[model samples]
Target: MNLFNPSKRVRNLYIKYGENPFVLLSKFIYAAHRQKWSKEEIERVISAAKKGNYIALIRILRSHTHIEE
Candidate 1:
């Protein structure tokens, strides 16, 4: 996936949850847990998300999770 330019799936997610970081973050966390990600990996994503750039957070989550379009 292109990191610099958002893909169609990512754009769709932005449209759905752009204004709600909490909701997006929750989903990311849930997905991480469901995938049985390591604590370190989950913590890394959470720390990155804490930077308050939801777009980047979404991109990071997308890279880590398998979300259908």
Candidate 2:
């Protein structure tokens, strides 16, 4: 997983906000809602995000945005 190859939107958010975990987590939840991701998937991603796993964050965001789930 290339750090720069996942969700461009999320990467941009990180670049813009300097990787605030809470803010990114909030955005991930909001985006999951908007993207209609499953509750389980959202919860899983949220859990991972809350743990401060950037790789999980990127994977989940890419999965949501790119329909990889």
Global lDDT scores for all candidate models: 0.57, 0.52
Let me know the TM-score candidate 1 reaches against the reference structure: 0.58
- TM-score to true structure, per model: 0.58, 0.49
What is the Cα-based TM-score of model 2? 0.49
Q: What is the lDDT of residue 36 in candidate 2?
A: 62
lDDT of 2: 0.52
Task: Please identify model 2 stretches exceeding 4 Å from their true place.
Answer: 1-17, 52-69
Query: Once model 1 is optimally superposed onto the true structure by TM-score, how far is the C-alpha of residue 59 displaced, in angstroms?
Result: 2.3
Q: Which ten residues in a row have the lowest lDDT in candidate 2?
A: 7-16
- Backbone steric clashes in candidate 2, count: 0
Worst 10 residues of 1 by lDDT: 3-12
RMSD in order of candidates: 6.0, 7.2
Off by over 4 Å in 1: 1-19
Per-residue lDDT of 1-69 in model 1, one digit per residue for the tens? 322234212222232446577777777666656666566766776776667577776666565454356
